[model samples]
Target: MADQIDDVDFALAAYRTDGEWVVAELTHDHLEDVDVLSAALRRFPGDTGTLGLVAIDEDFFVIVRVAGTSTRLLLSDVTAADEWELAASVLDFLRLPDPEDDDEPEPAGEVGLLADLGVPAATMAELIDDEDLYPDELLSEVARRIGFGELFDDVVGLTSA
Candidate 1:
């Protein structure tokens, strides 16, 4: 069987508009396939459009954003995805091969992809430096920096709320 996403542990779609946050209408099954996930992202409506947040088996998080024909990503721990179907499918979509035995979970793609949107890359590095934070916790920091801390926390159930 093809790699799937419903096997994913936690997934959510959210967008910010005119200073307010809104959770998009997410149909989980339709996005079970990577191609479909990409398609839905591109279809998301707005200027700073929709954002996809997923945490797989508490091992790592995948953030996906699309602008026109270009899609950007932030995969936490490329190695963690190796053992999970959802993470593997995302890695496949990004055209990355599985990691070797000596690999460590590191950020793949442009870490500054959301800098202009307000989540800075340097700040992310500091958070990951601890090496003990889970995918959701790291994402909480992202949401916090981007002005949606409370909202994202409520949706994702972050403890800092």
Candidate 2:
């Protein structure tokens, strides 16, 4: 089987309105796939515009076009023959943020807080048993009533536990 990309190894490379590149490492348990990332760029606030995969190192770098600008990122640090380092160097040449930096938070707005919440399996089961409430409606109502962030936290906590 092919080795799966770990969550910590992936970082999001997006562009800012000032033409600067932004690299935010993903901290979630699972890494976002290309399709999901593309969707996120479309939904980002302030008309940042769409994102497209431009180039890949075939080892580490996965360069993308965002809002008509090209941005590259180090997708992993497991260098077999300096490929990861070379990708990082290229990213540096492009003035992107270092993936090693933990100062910046992960990219937001794609997976809503509900997905992150740890709702209990039993609670979910009970909620599902309610014939009057669809799962989507229940989630939406929960999101609306207690705030999406809180709902996500609760769901995440419940599920993870």
Candidate 3:
């Protein structure tokens, strides 16, 4: 799985501390698997919880949220499990079946995970349903909706300037 880590475009952890949002880069060491990524998210201190956003191979994105002993996950494309180990791991973690070859791209897991934070599940669904947006762009929209667009862009080197 070490070789798979190189395919990650970016991994970041965002959370609130002292009523302010903090966005920071997450190491690539655990980027290829869901278990270690959840463990890494648990290490961050946050009033609500930690949000883990990872874009892989420019193909799909995964969102993992950790609060105390509770963890939630969302995979941008279920079909990605066919090609990505990380996406497959996420399906395993979520106790979901592996997507079939003929299955259309659809989001899997807790799409409403960010509801309390701001973005609704419906909006998340809409974003995932858009075929034109890449995984990074989808994640960027998520970060923007949750109030950390600029900070997220800065951390992921997506800043225009």
Could you estimate the TM-score for every candidate?
0.82, 0.27, 0.95
lDDT of 2 by residue, 53-110 (tens): 2222222223233343433222222221132333344334445555543332222112
Top lDDT model: 3
lDDT of 3 at 53: 94
lDDT of each: 0.70, 0.34, 0.88
Query: Which digits, one per residue and each the tens of the lDDT, describe model 1 over residues 1-161?
Result: 13545455557676766767765535666356556666786665655767787776667777887667767777777786667655666778788888888997677766786789787888776676557877778877787777676777777766674
Worst 10 residues of 1 by lDDT: 1-10
Q: Quick one: RMSD of model 3?
A: 1.5
Candidate 2: the clashing residue pairs are 117-152, 117-155, 117-156, 118-154, 118-155, 118-156, 118-157, 118-158, 119-155
* Deviation of model 3 at 108, angstroms: 0.6
- What are the per-residue Cα lDDT tens digits for candidate 3 across 1-161? 57687788998999999999999898888675888998998888899899999898988899999999898999998999988888999999999999997998888999998998888999999988888988878888888888888898888878522
- Winner of 2 and 3 under TM-score: 3
Residue runs of model 3 more than 4 Å from their true location after superposition: none
State each model's C-alpha RMSD to the native: 2.6, 15.5, 1.5
- After superposition, which runs of candidate 2 have C-alpha atoms over 4 Å from their true positions? 1-3, 18-21, 27-32, 46-58, 68-161
